[model samples]
Target: MKGETEGRFHTPDVSSITPGPRRATLRTADGVRIEAVHDPCAKGPADTAIVVAHGFTGAATKPAVRRAAGVFAQYAAVITFSFRGHGKSGGRSTVGDREVLDLAAAVEWARSLGYERVVTVGFSMGGSVVLRHAATHRGSGRGRTEAVAAVSAPARWYYRGTPAMRRVHWLVTRRTGRLVSRLGFATRIHTKDWDPVPLSPVEAVPLIAPTPLLIVHGDRDPYFPVDHPLMLAAAGPAQLWLEEGMGHAENAAGDALLGRIGDWLIAARPAA
Candidate 1:
């Protein structure tokens, strides 16, 4: 639904609600040490845990990420982490290619925390990771998600349809850009390209059927147009929300939008 609009909702401030102690370092199957944090629900004890995956150059500690987590904590226990090469985590980012392993580690850790159900919410680069993670671990219990929400995710890889994406391409593909990313953004980029080009998000979405899926995108997103979310919605039974006046990713997400997402997570159920 190109140009479709939704009512705007203002985000609430929850900066005073600090996240709980940092979790122990998580070890990915690929051996990356992922840093994570857990925030108990503000409403009360909950059986579910929401794992948040941040976009490129974003870490669990970023203000935007923390703000989102604070909002989510009102629904369920929240888990937020940095992918490899972002924040204090080890190794370099393969962008979204190998980040699924990072997500898996986070999901598994959440499960270990005694939560009966674990769902994932990811933004931008993180959005692609959650989609691929759900598909990749569909058959496995360790990382299989109960529900998945991908916000502002690309349907396919190598998308340079917009100038923001073109700039992102430069950040990942060029050494000078990588340096800038490290110094300015504190995100490290891998020097190599995807060898086999892992499963794209559109290809992964269909595989996530039976697992409740929600694809949320802003009509005014600069990185990816509505086509991205539309392609994802068309690929599977995902519920799509083409929000009006919204920008992109966590930064653009309002507390009202995040509250709706948390409400969805609370209501969503996996297929029997």
Candidate 2:
């Protein structure tokens, strides 16, 4: 939250056990310039690359974001990017709708860097983008995603809002939206678009089956109920990590969670 600016978010600098390679300015298909940090340790061409997308109001340099990147870097090249309007990246956030494009761009960027296999990890709204991208790839026969992992992702966008969320939404939309709009920030990014069909993780899971997925959520997460990951697991070859006391992005940084994710990725690697 401290890194959140008027438009973008910034993450803290992470210390790595081994210094990883660095790069900047990976351009996407839509012409938006995405700023990415690449960390490849002990590598010529990496065996795998893990690309991370942060949650709503999160940037590439957040503590959790850095931890996730570090976890993957232990075994593979890791590329972390801030979504449009959420970091040094260009363009506004289209919620998760057009953010799918951002994911695609990130994947392409990773592949271009000589990573033969690529896995995607996303948190919250970032998780939604991962599902959408996997679905889109499966539909187009582009190629299968090696693996996908999500943390605290909501199943639906406009679910029955909790009393707390309702109050928070009211307050933010009323007070914050007004201030953001007056200050020239596009507050409409938070507004939902009307679609007869839902675009959340629940609806997207059925399409991701056979493609390995790991869904981790806190049992006590107030924003997205624990049942969301349960529903997703029911639909795919997905494993659920329900931490008893963790909430929201709680697993985003933990060594235990990252170790589990690393093991999952190693086992789920695509066949050569």
Candidate 3:
């Protein structure tokens, strides 16, 4: 980071003698084209790679996601990708259901890059996906995650507890709301509801035991509320953080918080 004159502001210069964000298009097991990027660690080559799963309506190229990636890159290499139906990825968003496949692909890609250990960190809807993904692909060497962190995630499905959630439900359920979501948020939500209703985050958390789970939630979040994190924490043997004034996901995650999360990831160790 380069400071401006007279302490006005600092401009981040990620362009170094080393390579920058390596862009790629990954294909999920379900055949979704996931737009992804790899930001090498600022220090140098790293054995650990952090796979970032963004929230609903977030893209790998989005400023918020990129900022979080940059912060994490300080500690380890970072892999950021847009989920299906968001940004440049192909396919409709099943919300969190099939997004697990997208994450699996991203993790596999990270492994192919030769990173010895891979950690997943997600925000909001992405948080839910990481929980389910860790459970769904447990013990699978292909896309196995060494550790997991979910921030501002919902515990169950069809939660209409808050106005923000109600609006989210409307966007995914109604026709006109989908149009607005596509036009305004650039997110293409699927029209159909979950067929069998996959396992909830609380249910998934129990399966992720011994996998180093970390649940982070904000007390003041308008969406989901504190009960969500409480539910997730109660469902498994994991570490939990109840942030005092933090609001939502990536947008609300400042550099300081991200740095702490990075530190946690560095210190996290999975059971053998």
Candidate 4:
């Protein structure tokens, strides 16, 4: 890992003494290569690290994504990666269904680095990936996550309500949309429909019980309504944070909010 010096610090600010981020390329179980970066923990008691999964069309190098790593470095180690079909990662995105493998790869990478505890934090579409990943891997007895946090995630799938969502739907549902995605977002996503139907966020939440979960949603989010977070909170053991005027992920995630998430990851680590 590279050495870390400057970044916004939270309560622990442990990352002030930590090393800079280390860059690596990882392969998923399905053999898709994912571009990843790791930030080691600062000199302190916390041995926990965070694995960050970015939202749709977002890469590990986005300004907001990079900023999150800097802010999170204050409290603990962090690993941020681009999902398949985004950035330099290989393979097309199956949206929420097959993205679980992307997260699984990152979690395994964190364990290989000797982190005693790993918490996964995802935003928007990434939020759903973390949820399904946790549920799908729970009790598998291998590389299980210690905690999970979902920000501004949708509870259900195939939502087409808002104008933003409608545009997004077009991107996922039409062939022309796929071309636009490749040109604009550098993401190549599946154009077909889900056959067997993947587990929605709410359906997966129950399976993740006992694993500490934090659900943070903005009340003013234009993508998903408040009911999404409310439904998720009711389905599982989760601490819900309803921001007064939060928008979407990344750009909408301020430094203070990012630091708070760092605090939660630190606090959620398994007790010694």
Candidate 5:
């Protein structure tokens, strides 16, 4: 991921490169046309490929997501795209349930580009999607994902008294999770059912053993609390970093977090 400059956001000039900015309309398994942004840098054949997923209401062009893409460009080809209903992507937010397919579509896009090593980074809601993807992809024979990194993600939903998260279940489910069952994918806030695969990153961590995993969270994050990462780290070959005084989605400029991620990637290189 790219670093921040002077505590400000910097957008990558993907058009200046050889292949330039490759724009494509990706159709998810559910037939949603997701607008994807692909930056093919001048760097030689990429040794690794990274696909990034943003948090709720975030788009591919978001400053943090773009910064992450920029940071990864130094060592790997990077791809970022909006989950349906955000930015130019189509459809509505599934609250990280069906969004896993959207993530899969993005990963497939990177694989089609001939990237040998693949890594995925997800923020908040996007983090859950990547964790689910890793669990389901193992031994499926689709392809090998080298590693996964999650930032400010929640291992379990429905936690009581979380400061970072608003009571979205009311808005998401509308009528005590009953409307979701009857209405199905027509709920107002969430267009899909509420069955989120029942798998949390803490439980899924051991499944990803032998494959490096990194979990980063803010010390003051109100949403999931620092215990989420701590529990996750105890599950498998995982490393946890708690940024002091950082809140959920802290806009710490200067690529401070991205640098940590880059260092982890180098140290956690997958086996050959």
Candidate 6:
């Protein structure tokens, strides 16, 4: 990263220099145009693959996201994309409901590139999306996800315990808040509520059984306390990790932690 100056380009580092990703526009099953980027593994065509799902108010080009992608790229091929209503994608966000389609689209793209084992790693809202996506498309679709991991995700919807979550509710529900989010956060989420509310992460995690699940959380997270990941852990046979001082999302994820995530993905792969 560069100085505190705005609009200054970051000096590239060898550790963070991911091979040029082939950018493409992927159409979701619901006909949304999702902007996706595929970064082939530095090690060439390996059977294993990793699909990265970003959190709310996240985009593919963000430094944290790009750093994670670069780290993961060292082990397996990586695919990162912007969900609908965020970044360069089309259509409005239904929060996590319709967002599952975005992840499915990315997973399908990975399979299209001939990756046999696709392991999905998601953060926050993206964590919820991946859990639902794996359950909804379980044992189906061309690139049916083989393994799943959720980090800093809520167990249920409409949680407003923390001030951060309460503010998040405001951003997703109020018109004025949406405008603020558009102008300030650069996130274009719909103001409308979920029509026929989709299943929550707790509900979806159970269905992810037999398909290895990893649930990672931070004890110091402000938006959600320990209960969220614990409730999710109780629902199924998931490998749980409770970090000491981490806060929220990818921004809190350090290089060492990211390396462990990459190791988890590599370990999650079923023997070919």
For each candidate, what is the lDDT?
A: 0.88, 0.68, 0.89, 0.83, 0.69, 0.83
lDDT of 5 by residue, 29-91 (tens): 788777677775437566567788787767787777787778767666777888886777777
Ranking under TM-score, best-scoring first?
A: 3, 1, 6, 4, 5, 2
Error of 6 at 137 (Å): 1.2
TM-score winner: 3
lDDT of prediction 3: 0.89
Error of 5 at 14 (Å): 12
Residues 31-95, candidate 1: write the lDDT tens digits. Answer: 78778877888877789999999999999999999999999998998989999999999999999
Q: What is the lDDT of residue 44 in candidate 2?
A: 42
lDDT of 1 at 46: 88
At residue 25, what lDDT does model 2 achieve? 61
- How would you encode candidate 6's per-residue C-alpha lDDT over 1-272 as one tens digit per residue? 11111111111222333445667677887788888777888877678778999998888888888998999898898989998888888887777889988898888777766687888999999999889988888776674888888989999999999999999988988898888888887788876667788899999988886888888899999999999999999998888999999999888888888889888888885334
**Each model's TM-score?**
0.92, 0.79, 0.92, 0.90, 0.80, 0.90
The full ranking of all candidates by lDDT, starting with the best, is 3, 1, 4, 6, 5, 2
* RMSD to native, candidate 6: 7.4
Pairs of residues clashing in candidate 6: none
Report model 5's TM-score to 2 decimal places. Answer: 0.80
TM-score of structure candidate 3: 0.92
